[model samples]
Target chain A: MKANKVLINTLAIAITFMTLVPFVWMVSASFMHQGEANQFPPRLFPETFSLEHYLRLFISMNIVRYFLNSVLLSASITGLSLLVNSMAGFAFAKFHFPGKESLFKLLLAAMIIPAQVTMLPLFLMMNQLGLINSYFGVIIPGMASIFGIFLIRQYISSLPDSLIEAARLDGATDFQIYWRIVLPLAKPILVTLGLFTFMGTWNDFMWPLIIMTRESMYTLPVAMANLSGEHSQDTELMMAGAVITVLPVIIVFLALQRFYIEGIMLGSVKE
Target chain B: MKGKRLFKVWMSPALFLAPALLLIAVFFFIPVVVSFLMSFTDFDIYSLADSSNARFVGLENYKNLLSDPLFWKAMHNTLYFVFIGVPLSLFVSLGTALLLNSKLIRFMSLFRLAYFLPVVTTLVAVAVVWRYIYHPSFGLVNYLLSLIGVSGVDWLGNPNWAMPALILMAVWKNFGYNMIIFIAGLQNIPPELYESAQIDGAGRWQELLHITIPMLMPTTIFVSIITIIGYFQLFAEPYVMTQGGPMNATLSIVLLMYQEGFRWWRMGYSAALAFVLFLILFAATLIQLHLQKRFSTV
Candidate 1:
């Protein structure tokens, strides 16, 4: 039994180290000087920790612009999606209307259709709307997702209907009840959905790559992809760009991981 | 009075649902419908410049797709990925879950988080990182291989190795997600079964075969279906790391569609390819569900 325990522990630790190697290498290489990351034996830690790559990324490559673009785009998508999805979710959970069940079912079934199917037409639509190369091109489609609505609706459905009824008895308008009562009660889910949206928008590549034609309009992922293409040989510089692109999502994920995991569990368990 | 009350009840929900429904209708539903229609027409770069240039080419694109060797190649690659990648991913996930769920393990959550870290990171960023890691001469992978007295192999540059390299990165990136699901599944299994099996002189492997595997079947199915669907849409890894390169060894259906639709502006043909992908996914999902039902009945 003792020998078995030792074996399990050893395996666990070994797997954990292997799992973390890429991230550790990414961080270490990002701090290495130009040409230093390409050295013989592939140093796990920089010989001299330096921010030269990050400095070059900021000053020469103007990654700050892409950074800010990512922030703006992700934030807008998160905030707007929260409001739009939450309102619909609340209605689906609380309000009664003709065809509500069928409508919800239709939306649920639509999830099977891959987003790639819509890309070509959506791009043409955006072109017609003069939204091509604009933040709205990305933000608009992201404003309301069926999955977000489903998540919020699932959460809100568990909340006591009497609360909404009580607010209704207090002469609150539907919107007011949703804004003043339901929104506050739904904070945990809102945060979960918000993190999901923010990270998704931030890390999104294909759509942003398609929509944002201009270099200035590029999100972090698209910008990073472009950098990889243009500077494939600059290992340190690419690592720096990778770090910048991935850092915010990681921070957000680590901080709000409780809700995120809860959200995943909630999603997996059929309602 | 009754009519007014009915109107009020309907209006409230409608008002709340309007924005989301409208957005979904316009941005999602309409585009899907339009893309379906567009697939029947010869919508190309010329059509982009002038809408009138597009002509109704009934099923020609699909017919051409049938004959296109590249399409077949992409189909083969995608099936290769889905078939091999799904089982490998499930095995890794199930293995990790079993290990992590072991009572003897310490700091399980920390280990879980470490394994899951890749799942949360941006794929494009990780792909770029992996690109460097696959570097032949100066890469960490080759360097480690050298320490083992194995000669450096060109990971991404060799067509034989490129797909496998992508598969490795993908398995590394994704196993944690299904691990979490499998962990949940494992926890749900009644411990009395294991104890009963032990009392019956059943060994560890026998207990796993009889109890754990059967119990975890639903979760396994769920994970497999989702993994298959996700893998079918393989794009970012190839786009970022190899660009379907080393002589198109890593070319995926979605990448081909992207190249055709966006890069070359062959909209109709790309839409046909997209529909074919959708068909494959739909069929695969149906077959899985059918198998699930069969298993449940048996």
Candidate 2:
């Protein structure tokens, strides 16, 4: 049993190291001078440190513009979707109307329809509206997501009805009750859902890749893909690009991982 | 006063729901319907240039898709990924979860965070890093192999190895996600079941086989379905790392759809491919549910 415990501990540490190796290598290679990353026997660490690639990315490549674009896009989507979906989620949780149950069920059923099905027509629709190659094309479709609505609705429903009733007795209007009582009390799910939306939009590749056709409008992931295409041989430069692209989301996730992980659990558990 | 108050109550929910519901309707619902329609029509660049140029080509796209060798290749490649990758990924996730649940493991949360770090990183970055890591001549993988007196395999350049290379990276990127879910599942298992098994002289493996595995079946099913759906849509890794190359060994359905629609402007055919993928996912989900109902230990 002692030997078995030792073996388990060893395997656990080994797997953890192995899991982190790719990320470790990514950060390490980003600081290597050009061609050092590809050396035979693969120098695990740079013999001499360099920042040539990061300088190239920020100075000449002008990656800051793409970085800001990603940040602004993700932030806008997260903020807008939260407001819109939360209103709907609040109503679904507390209000009643004809066909309310049916409508909610329909929305739930629609979740299975993959977003790819809507991409073609949505692109064409955006083109007709002259929204293509701009943030509008991305943000308009992102203003509401069914999963966001469902998650918020699930959390809000679990809140006691007495709070809303008390708010109503205090002559709080419907909007005021939601804006004041519901939103604050539901802050945990809001953060969880917010992190979900933010990380999703930040890491999103496909929609932005399709809509943001111009180089100036490219998000970091789209820009990263273009860079990798144009500079496949420049391994060090690409690693630097990869590092900066991944860093912001990684930082956000690490800072709020409790909310993030709980959000996943909430999503997986059936309502 | 009663009527006025009733009207206000009626309007409240509608007002709350309108913006979100309208956006879903216009952007999501309408597009889904239009895409289904567009699949039957030959919607191409000329049609985009002038709507009058488009013509309905019912079943032609689907017909051609059935006969298309590349589509079959894409299908074959995707199934290879789903069939082989899903089980392997689940195994890794479950194994790590079990290890983490062990009392012997210290700093379990730190290890969990390390494992999950890849899941939250952008796939584009991960794929690009992996592209270099799979380099035949000077990659870390080959370098490590050389230490074992093994020859370096051309991971991404060789047709036979490219898909496997991709699968390994994908499993690495995704396993942590399901591992967390599995860990959650394991915590939900009643300890008494294990204790009872121990009292019955059941060993560790026997306890796991009898109690833990059966207890975690629901979570396993849910994780499998979610993983299958996500894995079926494999695109970014191949797009960055392989470009679906080395004889198109890693061409996925979505990658093919993107290439056909956006790159080639074959929107109608692309929509058809997308629909076929949806049908497959729907069937896969239903089949899993059916199997769970039949065999559910819970």
- Runs in model 1 deviating more than 4 A are B295-298
DockQ of all candidates, in order?
Answer: 0.83, 0.84
Residue A182 error, candidate 1, Å: 1.5
Worst 10-residue lDDT window for candidate 1 chain B reads: B289-298
Report residue B135 deviation for candidate 1 (angstroms).
0.5
Residue-by-residue lDDT tens digits, candidate 2, A1-271: 7998889888988998898898888888888988988789787777789999999988998699999999999999999999999999999999987688999999988998999999999999999999988898999999998999999999999999999999889999998999989999999999999999999999999999999989999999999999999999899998899999999999999999999999999999775
Query: Could you give candidate 1's per-residue lDDT for residues B1-298 as a string of tens digits?
Result: 9999999989989888999999999999999999999999999999998878999999999999999999998998888888889899999999999999999999998999988889899999999999999999899899999999999889999999999999999999999999998999999999999888889999989988999999999788888998999999999999999999888999999999999999999999999999999888888788877878887787
* Model 1 DockQ class: high
Q: Candidate 1, chain A: TM-score?
A: 0.97
Model-by-model lDDT, in order?
0.92, 0.92
Our tally of clashes for model 2 stands at 0
